[model samples]
Target: MFRNRDRSAETPAHETALACLEAGIAATLPERVVADRIALDEETIAVGGATYSLDTFDRLVVLGGGKAAGGLAAALADRLGSRLDDGCVVTTDVESGSVGPIEVREGDHPTPTERNVEATRTILDRAEAATAETLVLALVTGGASALLCAPAAGLALSDLQATTDALLASGASIDEINAVRKHCSAIKGGQLARAAAPAPVVTLAISDVVGDDPAVIGSGPTVPDGSTFGDALAVLDRYDLRETIPDPVVDRLERGVDGELEETPDAGARAVAAAADDWHSLANGRTAIDAARGVARERGYEPLVLSSRFAGEAGEVGRVHASVAAEIVAAGEPVEPPAVVLSGGEVTVTVDGDGTGGPNQEFALAAAIELAESGADAVLASVDTDGIDGPTDAAGAIVDRGTVPRDEVDPARRALAANDVYDDLDDRSALLRTGYTGTNVNDLRVLVVPAAD
Candidate 1:
């Protein structure tokens, strides 16, 4: 939940927006999601539409890494109870702790680290130990690409870290970033499935990517990878990062492209093919967006879900949202007044300044300026569903027509130009801070336009 909800919700519209955001995020919590999507019967377990007999497997083990993996492992442990033999899950430091019988290990995110490597090795070890009689429950989610760090042969952790940092700063889409990641890592891109070969692996994922592509989510550790080493090289070229990123990454990718190294397992790969029917997406941006829409309707507002697949530059996306608000206020083109326009998807910000802020913060700042300039009587709030936007402590921010005073518009513009929206939003008391909300379905945005008087 937002820590400053009361302080930020100074108006009825603000209150409604905050409530929608809370509902949206709550709908994706691992505990809630797992409980809704997974069920245990007397002798069988059901996940989504698939059911497996518990007696079929002599051992059940969990192995995965991500921001939500710890929570997912805990919830699953409760459901499996004594049936679970042992498990290990690597997650972000904030979410790490012992969960029932599972060992929850801590790791970094947005960047890989030595801790991540060690924790991921433990996860891989568990996966590799599984036999034909074992049922491997893989709890992969957003952030697993970083949390489950395992450099490819001849690549060091530092090479991955540098590549990750460079790619993140390049304003690349999550799909593109993961394409590169799937090539550079040893455990990602169906390698985890290969490690647990002969044993049936069931992956329960919380999608944080656009299109809800399992192959891109968490770099598709349990699913077949559609990307190739050539694709990875193309990402670096597209981002102009080949020269800037570590040389070793370039070399490894080049080697793979030249057929000197094996490519990530594809759909035809045995391990991926065997478990093709078992990968389940527990929740996604649409799940949160729908929850937000329901809450908006309950709050006496007509809900208009824009899309759950919006992408591109964060500031540009925010401007588009502002234009929608302006249209609703002026001519009610998309919908009449008293509407809460909702959207959910990941957005990226290209960092050119030393200042700090995440995509949602940048979005809020841009939208705030547009709302003030256009004189739209509306409140807008955006937050990363995982509760951490960029490297900042604030989840995102909330703003409205009054967020920017007349004299400070230039300053606000400067702040955004410098990639310092976090400080500027904080100065205006617009930053929304919520630390690590248990799950990730990407970014959520709410725009509330009041009915005209």
Candidate 2:
């Protein structure tokens, strides 16, 4: 939807911006990052710090699920070729084949469906038979929680959907949501690693969670789980979401938390005890920094790559970025005018209102509000590499000085209140939309502060 009249070639600045966005998103996809981290030698695969020699293993197979699991599987097949044995991966963004010996099955997202549950079962069956002589390449990435759906015993898909919806609507942080997800799923909370016991499991991960906590990232399908049913119940209680949760599902988790039900295996569990697997972090915020730097340089602006581990409430984070921009413009403390500050990380929305936007959108809108109040001459854009944010279609939004109003801005406040940042910026043509970018590197934010006249 290029609405401008210019049909000429894209300028270096425009191209750089687009390229940065694309690269930032692609870098988070499991296949793109994992394949690069894993190398194939004469007879072995070296992933991260662990090496699995074909000479030592009878078979090498890929089995897992996530938004990018299929892509990762396809890439591994490309590298291993005929050497790669049978495997299946469940994901939301399925495309035409790029590799053999790996099957890509379509799955759901945001909430798990019956089809997702069934596909997850299929993957589990494949993992259960893994032997020590076999190499289990478990591809884990963002969205694994929804992609690899298998409800706990007695939990139903409808129940999961409702609970998931509440969590989304409740504005619970990703960590909190996934904590509950880990407890409710049969395969999460390191259960997948447990299922593949006796086998050497090499997990090539692309972290979407801040700090990349293996146990929390994608609900830690292959890592040892330290979260308990009590933790899950605590999230529900902390968010006051108990009423929204299904009774049977709550009862099941409550039982587990109360000790009537067995707890999920902890760090000392056999999966960790067996020493049968290794966790490999393949990619993270580095890509975003590189892309941002490239964009800023191309735009004739100084680029400063800050720590990408940004986290906290979306609005609060946006205000911090705005303050930095204002400081740059007024005093040049961090950098002179004509500078860009780029960062990457996941942010949270506390769900204070009925709004249609993700963390990125909320951040942009919030920053725009502050920029307007302070009369800051800057433009801010934040986006989720996965394309869909929360439940909205817009990737994110862009905010500039023109976006900020001089008078009391009740509209922006209302938008933020309702979590409807998209509507607030719709008139300005500020919403950034890229449907399903096939990757998820968490959140990317770019701030451009121009020089004063």
Candidate 3:
């Protein structure tokens, strides 16, 4: 639920956009997603389209980390009840809580910390303790790359922390950032599956990445890694971050490229082959997008789902969305007026300025400027499905034609250029704050264009 929904609901268009956002987020909550995808029939348990016989394993334990892992673990624990022998999961402090028999641990995100390393050590220990009779249920989801940290040999936790910070600020795609992270970590890229070898690992994932590649989600701790050390080094080169990042990180990758370090486990690797058939993606951006589309239809608006795999710079994407709105208002080209455009995907910010704001905030601010310039009577709302945009507590922002004051247009442009749209949006009462919504399916954006008068 949006905490500031009432305050932001300035018009009918604002309310419709907010409703669509709420529907999208609610559809992906762990309780709803888990209940919809997982079911128990006596000794047989079904997850997605795959069924597992609980009678086959002597013990069943849960292990993994992510922003949504805590909620997923709690939902799964309730479903499995006494069948779940023991479990442990690391998540953001906001999502940490009691989960029956599962122990919930807190860790930082976007940047890993000493606490993350310690919590990850516990997860790896649990994985290493698994035997042939143990069945591990891995709850790998968004933010897992940061929540489950393990420094590779010859590297310290500080090395990882510094490298992670640099890569995130580089505006690299999640896949690229995660590719580098997998190579630097000891528990990523199917390494956790290797640690829990001989025990069948069933990965239940909530995908936040584009295309929903299992190898990229949570850096693929429970699946084979398709990325190599060479690939990671290339990512740094592409961003020109090799010289600026931690020295040890570059050295480690260079060594791996030279065969000094072993690569992450691949598809042919024994660990991956053992549990390759058990990985399941229970929810993703499409799950949320579909729900939002249904809400749009019910509200008497023709819904146009652009894509659930959008990427690139956030501001540019916002401008494009605004352009579409302008066209619809001008000539009703796309689907006529009273249309809602819905899209879902993860967007990146290059972080050229010292000001604080996430991709969603940047998107909304950019769209506001474009909407004002085009004189389109519409409303746009964009938010991270997890209810936290970037490092800020505000989920995102909602903007209308009047959002940018006519006289302050120049100041608004300056704020956006400085990446300081958070305060600007706040001053306009356009920010949407909902705390942590206990789920993450990347970002959801809605553009509501009412009938032209």
**Candidate 3 residue lDDT tens string, 60-127:** 89999998999898898888888888888999845455587788888898789988898889889999
lDDT by residue (tens digit), candidate 2, 1-453: 212313211333333444456556765665666556778866988866767678888888887777767777777777787788888888787753435878787888888888888888988998898888888888887888888888888888888899888897776777788888888888988888888887877787777877888877788888777778888999989989888899977898889877887666677787654432488777766665676677578768888876688888898999899888888878997888677788988888878776677888889878888888888777777888778777888787777666757663787878888887777776666777777766677888777766567
| Model 1 stretches astray by more than 4 angstroms | 93-96
Residue 50, model 2: Cα distance from true site in angstroms: 2.7
lDDT of each: 0.90, 0.77, 0.90
Candidates in order, TM-scores: namely 0.98, 0.92, 0.98
Model 3, runs deviating above 4 Å: 93-97
